[model samples]
Target: MSQMTLEKRFGQSTVFVASTLMENGGVPESATPESLLKEAIHVISCGYEDKTDWGNEIGWIYGSVTEDILTGFKMHARGWRSIYCMPKRPAFKGSAPINLSDRLNQVLRWALGSVEILLSRHCPIWYGYSGRLKWLERFAYINTTIYPITAIPLLAYCTLPAVCLLTGKFIIPQISNIASIWFISLFLSIFATGILEMRWSGVGIDEWWRNEQFWVIGGVSAHLFAVFQGLLKVLAGIDTNFTVTSKASDEDGDFTELYMFKWTTLLIPPTTLLIINLVGVVAGISYAINSGYQSWGPLFGKLFFAFWVIIHLYPFLKGLMGRQNRTPTIVVVWAVLLASIFSLLWVRVDPFTTKVTGPDVTQCGINC
Candidate 1:
């Protein structure tokens, strides 16, 4: 292919270029323009035959969108190893997406890449079994790929409270004392894990909470979409375009990027989630009041779940609002439109209404 390309472009001159470079010792400083071009072509063609790996594996691997990770994993699978170095001062610095849209798109790209790997032949779950890759390292890679799948359960969990509020019923079965003890133990373990992570990593409490908040926001939005997008590519052979993340502009005023808004479909899920949870809280509380419930247990339980969803998506809500003191008029209108439509649907459906059965149909009025 390289020879064909060179012939097509340079035709008979390719021979002269190679001959010149041979005499020039392949050094650009000592070589003519034609010789320099030949030197580049030699490296591109792997003519020197570097003994590190095969020609294809000379640089980054290319199957997945995240070629860097794929390359590293392949190296490790082949018995190669890497070291960790943490300098007291920073070794390098990089820019980040300062705005919500860019950040979400960046996350979407990464999640999509992970999904690509998860569904591919090189998926760490079942791949590299015959290789030198250790079990723990393989497990870490598996975790990286499968993390996006968590969005499925997360979305269900987030929407559960809303569904329960709207339908006036809980789908979860009543648990016995043993189940309650198990639940308490699980909660305590999770709490202990978080505390240990904070202490060991030197991460502040607020930072840990922020990480949790962003995890939900991305899980429901970007990761959820990535799973579907990846399925489309893998199952249906439809391709997704890779988009480069936009970086913060130095020309902008301080933190201006944070207030900048760009429309993306990724925003819709989280926005809807925020609205639904808020509605659930309001409707559940209103129902509790109207029914004059002697026990506040169920109401509080539903409210806790609803509020949990809302709190997780609060950052997303703020991003939609942008720099305005109030939410933008467009967002307000959109929210109101959704609320109105859902309200009409709820009235029509009335899922929780009890059926009285009335009189027998055989002895009914003239209409029957």
Candidate 2:
């Protein structure tokens, strides 16, 4: 019964509404329980339209997993406006996922939904151009759907420092004096924005920092997975299962659930990322120690970026560790296995050494 309610709420609401609307030519003026049952029976036999037109034109848009966002986008495209309101008293409250695993799963569902909309035909980037969607409004919608794509660049940004440290090649180009000023200005501006928001909104610095941490954690893990999942569904007709996040149980009052780990494929990317960054930090420090003070400057730059990634993932790392022996053995094995492979690959590649000519090439008359 709960499953039926969930399907009706999130997945099948469009179908239900469409069935009634199309059958009655609009909402009926009056109805009885008997008539309702008959209508239900009729709908059960006759399916609803799957396309954007017809039934979906009225209720929640049905093509994507995120019907709420799609519905709002469609409404806005037709010139409907929305206003933000803050009441003096609390208007609504609900249970939220408190555990690390549940929280990550919740984030994964949202990211997956956003990815679905992004790849769908109703994507705000290309769709709604013919409608009355204002430029700013359209841009906002575009940002909502497009944000999952940022995981790609975020992952790269997180990985590049480690790669540079391992290879002994600081390939990142140095900017000019003018560019340096611009870079510093941009960094300061971000700090200023955070400061102003905290000051005006009465939000704590710790809360602000936690938000930043979760952004990186979710980006590298859930959002990254969502992108690939979305691509697979779109290109190969493969579908991802929609797993609802588990709600906090009564025992969660002590927050013991917060440390509990659950095995999920979503854990793989972030775990691998964490291991690589840690390895990078160790390898970088070792390299700097062996090379002496002359190498310290470049090492500082590399370490700064690598440490930044590590700091953002600290909370996630803590969750993985859990309390005492409660941590899952599977997670430990996978993380260690991946870390070992990465370390071995870095050693075998030995990018710091110059290539030596083979004896066969040296013996050849012509240059090989």
Candidate 3:
């Protein structure tokens, strides 16, 4: 169930009208639920009798998970300023999804909702009320709303390294090159900053690492699917139904009954990526050995990324193979399709021509 609380500061000004208000002639017979909601806010902001407080009139409406944030965005776009509060002592607490499938569905719903708002006329960037928003606020809203779109670029980044490894194609600069140093430095800087931010947010190192693991898992499974679903809804006029997260059960410890086959589709991308990376790692090691360890540095880089993918995907792999966790047949089909596409890319790139020429021994006689 959805819940909300009006802050003490806004309590007196905010009016909560009942059906009785209509009988008393306070609200019109023709007033709709939407109109009544608007009127309540208006009356509160405008005040009744001698009291008129126009500028400070702000309203908040809570909808289902799929609509709540959208409602907030629409309201903000109508020249209203709102702050999202996360009190030190939580004002409200709710159960979250305890399993992977339910968690993914929750994330997908959020991503789809944000995409819907971003595509709508109420989009903060181009909407009429956009001018009323501060520049910083506008940027922040835009960033938040367009989060789903990042999945596309993220997908490419995640897959491209594995693809390169499979095809014996190197995108990273040579170890001896200045660009390599810069690239390594930049990656470490971003990683370190992420750790610092996580620490600042009161997360421990283990928790932060676990969060990153889930970040990869959720990005591939939920985020990518949501982006595609959102685009299909917007472009093809397809309707995407929302799935409510499963509530925690106190009486029964087992919640597996709440799990559905629909979630099995999400396993495809991560599973396929894992398989490809595993194959790439094996092939990379073989090629490095065959080349008399001439390309150990580049092979090591490829294997490192492949290992990263494997680490994040270990749980998914286990689930796929587990008899108790038996995945849907459709997941197998999707995995095969993904593998075929990868194989085509590998063949097209022609891994045979990718011989690594060891560095000139004379360039560093003693060091060599």
Best by lDDT: 2
TM-score for predicted model 2 compared with the true structure: 0.77
- Which regions of candidate 2 deviate over 4 angstroms? 1-58, 195-202, 249-256, 350-368
* lDDT of each residue in 194-230, candidate 1, tens digit only: 9998998889999999999999999998999999999
lDDT of each: 0.77, 0.78, 0.68
Using all chains and alpha carbons, the TM-scores for the candidates as numbered come to: 0.78, 0.77, 0.70
TM-score of candidate 1 to 2 decimals: 0.78
Model 1: CA > 4 A from native? 1-55, 325-368
The digit string of per-residue lDDT tens for model 3 on 1-368 reads: 11122323233322333332333324445567887677577555634322222223334333324566655555565555665567899988877766667777788888777787777766767865534666777787788778778777767777766777777777464467687778899999999999789877878888877787777877887888888887788899887888677767666566654443345467778878876777777777888888886799777777777787788777667656655556777777788788778868776867557567776888878787
lDDT value, candidate 2, whole model: 0.78
Order by TM-score, highest first: 1, 2, 3
